[model samples]
Target chain A: MIRILLPAHLRTLARIDGELLLAIEGEATQGSLLSAIEGRYPQLLGTIRDQITLQRRPFLRFFACERDLSHEASDTPLPGPVVAGEEPFIILGAIAGG
Target chain B: MSKVRVLVGTRKGAFILNSDGKRQQWDVSGPHFGGWEIYHMKGSPVDPNRIYASQSSGWFGQLIQRSDDGGKTWEPVGNKFAYAGVPGTHQWYDGTPHPWEFKRVWHLEPSLHDPDTVYAGVEDAAIFRTTDGGKAWEEMPGLRGHGSGPHWQPGAGGMCLHTILLDPSDPQRIFIAISAAGAFRTDDGGATWKPINRGLHSQYIPDPNAEVGHCVHHIAMNPARPGVLFMQKHWDVMRSDNAGDSWQEVSGNLPTDFGFAIDIHSHEPDTVYVVPIKSDSEHYPLEGKLRVFRSRTGGNEWEPLTKGLPQQNCYVNVLRDAMAVDSLDDCGVYFGTTGGQVYASADGGDSWNAIVHDLPAVLSVEVQTLP
Candidate 1:
């Protein structure tokens, strides 16, 4: 099972409380995990990433295993802890507003 | 009891203000969709319970929220707005060709007769229609595909189609206004369009009387007289009597003509309202006083409505889509300001009061008269 942590607004949108767990059929890369997430919650198709370009929105960041994975490639494999569901892949709205 | 529900969209969230027909003593609901930018919210004229809201953010892109039971509950609808065909480029600010991209929905005009059908005017300049209550949207490309699209440019507000007017007399006719693209009319639904800016003069543009490049801030038409239209341009107040075939300047008497919002009284077709800003560069009212100018003659002669409003030291702007009217016998006028104030004039424009003093910089105001 791969665990993911969504931002507050997205969690409200998906109507989920606490962490979300999903079983991955293929390699647990950022791209595949996002695709699976969107597939499950079709309402979140374009919230975290672009629907066509699949690029992460400028104001969103990704983190896993105490490391920032936002700058990493979408196809790159997630940390082992995140893949094993020991740690959550966090999707965060970037901190900029005062 | 017949009641009035005021739907307000602000910079931070959406608010629902309810009151009886007396127009006094109100009950305020929400900051629903809190922390998100609610660009515009409007209820269908056919079904007052059905409401559509445009919610967007820099991080989450765009979202459409619909409420079937007035403003009590809401659910997210389709957010995707794809342009038709090749999605060609328009003129960028720097004179370069910019590819068309969907940014956000600036306005939503529900069908006059069909509750399920709604029209959306979006930024980056496009019109989208949804037949299944915003579940899906398809572009009416003829407005942009009529061969003059390459010359359309953004007017500081980023190429937004902010106004959409449906002709009540002729269901087949529709009018849409874009910033810096003037106004367009489609006689055959959305299949064909023509520029209706015949006499608009904009000194800022290369050609002062160009047919296609004037920044039309807002356009209002009386349902009883669908052929007559009133427009508040970037620097002039105008009127068209022959269904936009030709326009004549109506910026007469009192104050500057620069403003954003314009609306007509529901009960009186000749009575129109406009908020004059200081100038094209300064968007606020003159001398720190916020006043709504009313022209009972429909054009030229005007009077300022100032009772129950801020008379001094005010520097707020009323956006193009931020004003609306409720069709009560007394005729209530409502508008929201950039300083987070929603003002309501219960007895036409004579007496005014702020329904809410503090919100998140209101972007739009819509009213529904309940039976």
Candidate 2:
């Protein structure tokens, strides 16, 4: 089981109260996790990333295990704690704009 | 008895105001899609119950919300707006080639005959159509494929295709206006287009009468007379007789012609309304008085309709897509301001009342006359 924490607006969009728990089939990478998340809640398809380019929106970031993982390769393995489901992968909106 | 549903899109969320034919009292139901920028919300003329909203945010990007039950409930549809083909470049503000990007949708114009078909005018200046209601969108590349598209540039409000005017008489002919790119017309459905901007003299641009590159603020045409079109350009009030073939300035006696938000009356084809702002730099009512100017003589002669509007220290700007009219017996004129007030004149700009006092800085206003 992988735990993911979405931003407030995305959480509201997905209608999820707390963290999302998804069981990964293969390696627990950002690409695999996001594919699963979008598969479950299709409404959040283009919210966190561009639909055509599949690039993370400039205003959004990814973090887990007290490290900034947004720049990491999408297929790169997540932190051990995040993969172990002990620490949740956090999808955060950047602290900018009014 | 017939009622009117006013769909107001604001900087934050969407609001729906309902009132009977009287248009006196109102029941406001909103902040729907709260905390998101509702750029435009419009109901289909063919199916009033079907409403499409362009809900977006700088953080979450763009979303299309569809309401089948007349703004009562909404469901998120498609948000992907991919540009066709290579999606080449247009002139940026500094006259540099900027790659065309897909931004948020600025306006949604539903089909006149089919509820499932709709057109979207989006930022970065392009048009897209969705045939399956709002589930999917495909770009009509001809508008951007025009030879002069490489020279088109953005206005101060970004390069946005803000106006989509469907020709009621000829279904194949459609008119769309972009911020600094001027107006374009397509005679063959959405396949091809031509820039219909002659006699438009913009002092800001290099050649005052250039073919393309005019910042048209807004354009309005009565469906009854599709041939005659009225435009509120960045600096002048213009009228076109031969369906955008040529334009002539009709800004006769107005204080300042720089303003946004123009609409024509429902019954009377010659009757038009425009809220004149001070200037493009100072986007507020002149002399701190909010007055709606009506041109009954089609454009030259104008009268100020200022009965119920604020005449004292008011500074609110009416955006390009924030004015609409209901086809009721009395022809209600509605507009929303940057100060978050939605004003409605039940009797065709005779008197006005604020249907909603405080919203989140309205971006667009659209009305649907319900039976």
Candidate 3:
């Protein structure tokens, strides 16, 4: 089980209250986790990343286990605590003011 | 009893204001899609219940939302807006070749006949149409494929195709205006287009009479007289009688011609309205007094309508897409300002009242008259 936490706007868009728990089939990588998340909630297909380029949006970051994984390769395995459901992988919006 | 629903898109969210035929009382329902910039929301002319909204964010990119129940419920649809082929380059601010990029949708114009079809005017200057409501969008690349596209440059605002006017008399004829690319018309549907700026003179460009570098703010035409088009250009109010083949300046007896929003009266096609701002550098109303100028003679002669509008200490601006008209018997005129006030005139432009006092600096206003 992989626990993931979305930003406030994404949570409102996906209509989920708290953290999302997903069952990963293979290695818990960013690519596989995003694919699974988008497959489950199709409305979030292009919110966190670009649909055509498949690049993460510049104003969004991925973090887990008190470290920034935004620059990590999509195929790289997530932190052990995130994959084991001990700590939730977090997708946060930049702190830029509106 | 007839009803009027005003769809207002703001920097923060979308707001829907409902009122009866009298237009005395109102009901506000919103901050829908809260915390996101709702650039434009418009209802289909054929089916008033069907609405399309452009929702975007700096952090999340762009998303299109549709409502079958008149905005009561909304569902996110397809947001993939890829260019047709190799998206070519356009002139950048420094006159350098810049790759075209999709930023966000600036306007949405629903089809006049088909509820499922809508046209989206996006930045980087292109038009996309969705036939399955808001589910899928395909670029109509003919507009951007014109010969002079490479020289097109962005206006003070990004290079945005912010105006899309559909001709009701002839289904095959469509008119679209970009920020600094001027306006173009398509005679054979969306397959081909030609620049329609013949008599436009802009001092900002090297050649004052260039065909494709005029910055048109907004264009309006009453469906009754589709051939007669009125334009609020970057510095002049113009009129084109031969369907934009040639234009002549109609900015007569007006204070300053620099403005943004422009619209025609619902019942009176000859009556035009415009809000004159200070200048391009100073966007506020002149002398801190907000007033709406009306020209009943189509142009040349004008009068300032200020029955209820602020005459002093008002420094708000009306955007290009922030004005609209309701086609009731009396003809209601409405416009939203940068100060977050939506002022409406139930009986044309004679009187005004703020339907919504504060709403996150409105970006666009659209009204639908319900039977």
What fraction of the correct interface contacts does each predicted structure contain?
0.54, 0.65, 0.92
Off by over 4 Å in 1: none
- What lDDT tens digits, residue by residue, belong to model 1 across residues B1-371? 77999999998999999999998988999999998899899999989999999999888899999999998999999988888888889989887899988899999999999998999999889899999999999999999998888888999888999999999999999999999899999999999999999999989778888878889999999889999999999999999999998999999995899999999999899999999999878989999999999999988999999999999999999999899999999999999999999999999999899989999898999999998
| TM-scores, each model vs. reference | 0.98, 0.99, 0.99
The alpha-carbon deviation from the true structure for residue B212 of candidate 2, after best TM-score superposition, in angstroms, is 0.7
Tally clashing residue pairs in candidate 2: 0
| Candidate 2 lDDT score at position B297 | 88
Better of 1 and 2 by DockQ: 2
CA RMSD of all predictions = 1.2, 0.8, 1.0
Write model 2 residue lDDT over A1-98, tens digit each, in one string.
89999998888888899999998889888999999999999999899889998889999999998899999888998888998999999999898958
Alpha-carbon local distance difference test for all models:
0.92, 0.93, 0.94
Q: Write the per-residue lDDT of candidate 1 for residues A1-98, one digit (tens) a residue.
A: 98899998999889999898998888889999999999999878889998877989889999888899998998898889999889999999999879
For candidate 3, what is the recovered fraction of reference interface contacts? Answer: 0.92
TM-score for chain A of every candidate model? 0.96, 0.96, 0.96
- Across all models, the iRMS values in order are 1.1, 0.5, 0.6
- The regions of model 3 sitting more than 4 angstroms off are none
In order, what DockQ does each candidate have? 0.71, 0.84, 0.91
lDDT of 1 at B335: 97
